[model samples]
Target: MLRAAMTGAIAAAIAVALAGCGAAPSNSGEGEGPVRVTTTIGQITDIVTNIGGERVEVAGIMPSGVDPHLYKATQGDIAKFEDADIVFYNGLHLEGKMTEVFEEMAEHKPTIAVGESIDPASLIEVANADGTQVYDPHIWFDVKLWMQAAETVQRELAKLDPDNAGTYEANAKAYLAELEALDAYARERIATIPEGQRVLVTAHDAFGYFGKAYDIEVRGLQGISTASEAGSKDVTDLRDFLVERKIKAVFVETSVSNRSITAVIEGAKKLGHDLKEGGTLYSDAMGEEGTPEGTYVGMVRHNVDTIVNALQ
Candidate 1:
């Protein structure tokens, strides 16, 4: 009896995984008819859904907390991409692994890389340890940049669905105000952490804009992409830095595994520095669908709250 129950549970788990492998249905309003759209990240999905409201149906190719850099779309995801009226992505090499697929989709659909619309000068470029500069593609970390991205989405949505232009504009404006408020809240909360402890170390290099906006020093074990493996030297350097600076905590990312971070902690301990576990931070993606961190605004707020509470 137990064996039969275990087999059934395993089969059910496989079914759920297979289901999630495909694209989710459009969240369009009743009787509105299908107007397909696909987003790269859940945050963008939320923005599109908010402005599009009942007039449009939106689906995200990448699930919450999935690393966009390493996401591999299945056969079902490709089907959704082919059928989308518009494809919205946070370009600037963010969709590292899926860029080729999006490019191919652009041949057939009105795919938009929203981040590309932002002024290049406003973004901060990252450098390798050897000092060659690379563009930081995680612009959504900064509320200001995210608001700009949202506006771009609003414009594109308006262009596609002229009848709902007014609705989109109003929704975008309200959402932008919320983003502004979140920026203010982050600033106030982050100020509580002492200047000396304002260092943020995470699993990957996704918080350049967050560090710049909030005056925190950011460090990541891995590069911009989780696809890249961290070297022993990279771990050693971070371990030494944490010990030398006496940083109290280092954070774990929600999307990435904690192996690298745990290694860093152990290395630090061996060097006579004990580091605490800073709370889990939302990096490559937001929280689950219903929680406070599920929405874009809530995601940023939750990050700020977690960082402040842990570091301060």
Candidate 2:
């Protein structure tokens, strides 16, 4: 079993990591130019960059292929956060490891949790180890929910840089429209997969929101947080499920290890179900900077295209 990872030591550990990194720049001084924005993940970074355009200097703490669930902040990241005019993060524990740092910074900065801005009623509940409920934080998988996040970014950007409020609003309007079109594309492509084969199996439960939005059944060997372990029973059960349902493919995430999914495939193969590896999905991280999967919209399109092609 994985250790209960979210102890008080998390913040203290991060503080220690940032201690040696000398003084960081401040946003308080007069004659500030472009808005210095720091985002916790690439997806959030993409949105802020699109909405802020040439007016904001955006830095993403977690780079491509880094798993946010277990990401630890370095001294340079601390400096970036400290110097940022505004900070945006996906809340509801998606950045579980960085929650403490974000909470502390929220006290004095324009730090915003874009995920928290979504209507709680629309958020999907996941059970924790203590049987308590927590919302799934992978809202970006659902294009519509991501649109909400973009709106929140727009609101925060306007608040932080009122001088460019109109520009931010206009950019947000255009991006939101693009997101609407992306949502339609996802739905259409997903519908192409035969209804019975629409089930999505990933390494973890990150795709719950995506499944809900796209009308597919999603299963994972591990729970919502990757910090949790997939026990033998869980693996066996998933293996049996795949074999029984004749699931054609199972996916690996770009940021997450594929060991669990591989186990499922081996288990199913032993039972005479030959499953294939579906192309990797950008779950916690987007693709490299220059690729289509690097941007949020491009990532979504890539995912839908991969899934439809694999399962069709």
Candidate 3:
């Protein structure tokens, strides 16, 4: 979830944590060797870097495990945007606070919103309690949709650097095939769980697409946006659902805090259900660099393994 509603105290703590850490300004030096590109998140960066190879220098604005919804651009990030030959963002307002900034930068450079290029009808829209639809920006949760997004990025990158079009297309095709295999693997792994226990309760509502793809029932403590508060009603409602279903485990996200999930555990305990920590699931962001879940494919595989081990 891109949006995070932080209390004043929490906001202050975050600010203090970020204080005095300076990132490099945008890369400069006009004499072109490799084209410079900027990505809003690590997933985009990884794909771009993979396809571009050594022909492009790519920088990711949001680090691994950082929440995109609440990410604020710093002075260093502005420089990176200004210097890039192309910019890639997840789109559908995933970079909630940075949307306006990216829009402004798009006027000066080639900017691609990968998610927006995918057909809207193909996307799964989230609904409010009254059933009104909002675009679910977490399309990467579904491997099929993510492959589409990767193609979109490949097309844009090829357009920007036509000299390397063949390489980009080939890499995209290979990566897409890997993504397809990953989807098959996830389906098989998830099938090992009892049919009735295919319920997935997580820290936030980021897994609607995952549920749709894998035939699992997904529930979350918070709404689509971490910006929203997890009220008493939300906790109570989830607690009742867990108890009714006799769910044994639930998940915590990589980027989001575990406070709300802890509340669910407590609620389940009071209701006589012996719930356990299912394991940490990578939700909003991938794992740390060089880890098994650092790349897109690795992240999905790790998620499947964690879910299967917990539920089986």
TM-score of each: 0.87, 0.92, 0.88
Output the lDDT of residue 312, model 2: 91
Error of 1 at 282 (Å): 0.7
RMSD, one per candidate, in order? 8.2, 3.1, 5.8
Q: Tens-digit lDDT track for model 2 on 92-171?
A: 88887677787677655677999999999999998865577888889999999999999999998888777788989999
lDDT of 1 at 157: 79
The most accurate candidate by TM-score is: 2
- Angstrom error at residue 171, model 1: 0.7
Candidate 1 clash figure, as a count: 0
TM-score of 3: 0.88
Which consecutive 10 residues in model 2 have the weakest lDDT in total? 21-30
Error of 2 at 87 (Å): 0.7
Query: Which residue pairs collide in model 3, if any?
Result: 2-69, 3-227, 4-227, 5-227
Q: What is the lDDT, from 0 to 100, of the residue 238 in candidate 3?
A: 91
Q: Which residue pairs in candidate 1 collide?
A: none
Residue 157 displacement in candidate 3 (angstroms)? 1.2
Give lDDT per model, in order.
0.80, 0.85, 0.79
In model 1, which runs have C-alpha deviations exceeding 4 angstroms? 1-34, 128-132
**Higher-scoring candidate on TM-score, 1 or 3:** 3
lDDT of 3 by residue, 210-295 (tens): 99999888999887767666888898999889999988899998989999889989989998998877999887788898987889
